[model samples]
Target: MENFNTDLDIAIIGGGAAGFFAAINIAEQNPNLTIAILERGKTGLQKVKISGGGRCNVTHAEFIPSELVTNYPRGEKELLGPFHTFMTGDTIAWFEERGIELKIEEDGRMFPVSNSSQTIIDCFINEAKKHHVKVLYNHSVKSISTEAYGFTLKTNQEDIFCKKLIIATGSNPKIWNLLSDLGHTIVAPVPSLFTFDIKDERIKDIPGVVAKDVEVKVLETDLESEGPLLVTHVGMSAPAILKLSAFGAVELARLDYNFKIAINFICHDGEQCMDALKTIKQDFAKKTVSNSTQFNLPKRLWKKLVIASNINETERWADLNKNQLEALVDQLTNAVFKVTGKSTFKEEFVTAGGIDLKEINFKTFESKRIPNLYFAGEVINVDAVTGGFNFQNAWTSAYIVSQSINS
Candidate 1:
């Protein structure tokens, strides 16, 4: 730090998605911005290697900024302007221009047509190399000090000075601590995307059963979500649970990940369901209750719900009594599952908190608290539900940082 040789003109901390993206874009646009990505690991872009089951979900198919911003539980308001600047469409085009083709899944998630995460990693690496963005690996940042010129970063390898600094380290507490020491506020991190852990007779042994459309509500809370729900070995997953998990990250964490969720298996009102059941009883009087799966629900899950409603497997629809009908209606409309805990996907774990959004100037993604201090990616308090949304945030924020740098 004494020499203050200014090792880089633009120094990016973290070699993950946002870090590499910002560095490459800035270097390519400016052509003379001496940029380097100080990655703490021996290798970079490891998350890119394993995301989307190794296929690398690049960005979601959402084309509108307003709709796209809805996916993020935090930073929804702040990112609206940034997404307008650079978002899903721009992300798709950016990769397309680099000769990578992306395909959209039925669920709106976009991935490399090559079906390999390596494709994305290669593109970023090649782009960085072509733009002369030096990627310094194994340079774990220990501390950061703001200097008159720019900033001083003390890493495991060396202390480097830069004219401008961009922090894109995603959900790294140590970096957050460093930022805090530099007078930035950090929102306490909480698990975002996760699955509820439930052990119930209704859902047990019904793993792999998927209800096409269902409504899930956290009991006693305003938290609710609607989408396809999948019954896993432990409990429930898919977009329905993931959305609730993201939106209720803070509330659920405050609940200690222990709460109860009411699931509407049929996505129908209790009265309508009861009336439908009456019609179904008359229409399928001879049919076994458990065998005749209703509401397009998977057979296994239907049977479990039927049995949980006190309807035996051998009972026919005609034999169902008034109490049995009411019970069945309740089970279908408001089945409650006690969520004892949560399970996070190790490779795709997302945090709901980071640098407070108010502290950042979204117009330029620069720090209002500190001059020339930029922020991007999950390093900020913005996080989204599963899909390709988290990656889109990385791309959008990184792109904005690059644009801000050159402008």
Candidate 2:
């Protein structure tokens, strides 16, 4: 490892999204001040490179700060103040100013027009280089200490001192420990943005089937989401399930990672499902019950629905009794799956807990107790549902901290 003793105006621990962004922003704003990003891994921006299955879901296109912030299960309340300063619009503008244009999908996920995460990685790398930000890979910070003048960081490579320190190490426990040891309170980290593994025959064969708008509810909790739902080989995924996983992350972890999830395959407001079922019975009276679904559910899913509803697949829709029709409506509208366990959503996973939000000043993302000590990104107790909300959190927090550091 290379060793250096040069003093820096700011030393950012972790070269992830928030760290690099903060470094670039600070260096660009204050060119005379030296900034360094110390990363533990062999390569910086590992998460950014792998996010969105390599395309990098940069940020959601939601312009309304209040609406966009609701996606965050952990940091929604604390992020309100920060989003007012730098929201999704600011994130897009920041990237656009660097020559990277972002495109918004129908689902509101924003990705680079290049359709490559490398576009984002290259942008950050080039910006950091342009600003002369020192990026030290494989230099893991072991601890940090505060002094009257500034802060001191002990890393595997060498010891360094800086006037300001930003903790952007993300959701790693080791990083959390270093901060906690530095007198920062850390909320225990728990897995977020995962999928529920349900071993039910209804969805067993149709692994890749997706529902555009489905609702998922945790059996005994108020956690719920309405969005796209994907049926995976192991279980269920997609935006809705992923969002549900985030909201129930801490509670699910406490339950030893085992819980039951109820899924309403179709989201009907009130008695619409019953009315639809009656219409289906009347319109498709000659068709087989299994062949007469009201909506565009997959064929295999229709079969499963018939089986789960105890209606014979070959039975004509006209032969369906009142009880059978009600059961079918219930199956379509309030399908409940038994979620036995959980698995990580590799594309966009985050931790639910981190530095307690109460301890940090949301307006600046600065530690209320520790002067000049700031926290951003996943390092703090803030995580959002997939679709660029997580990246937005990183951006908003980093932007706020940058302003605070300059102020």
**Please, what are the lDDT tens digits per residue for candidate 1 over residues 79-146?**
89998899788898888999999999999999999999999999999998899888888889999999
| Model 1 vs. true fold: TM | 0.98
**For model 2, how does the per-residue alpha-carbon lDDT over 1-407 read when each residue is reduced to its tens digit?**
55555588888988999999888888888898888999998998989999888999999989987897788888777777788899888889999998999998998899999999999999999999999998999887777888898898888878889998898988879878877887778888889878888898888888888877777777787777788888899998888888777888888888876777666777784388778777877888899978766577777787898888889878998898878877877787778778788888564567888898889988888888888888889888888888888888888888888888877
Model 2: lDDT to the true structure: 0.84
RMSD in angstroms, all models?
Answer: 2.0, 1.7
User: Which regions in candidate 1 have their CA more than 4 angstroms from the true location?
Assistant: 1-6
Clash count in backbone of candidate 1: 0
Clashes of each: 0, 0
State candidate 2's TM-score: 0.95
Model 2 regions lying over 4 Å from their true place: 1-5, 269-271
Model 2 residue 340 CA deviation (Å) reads 0.7
Model 2, residue 44: what's the lDDT? 89
C-alpha lDDT (0 to 100) for residue 318 of candidate 1: 89
Give the alpha-carbon lDDT of every model.
0.91, 0.84
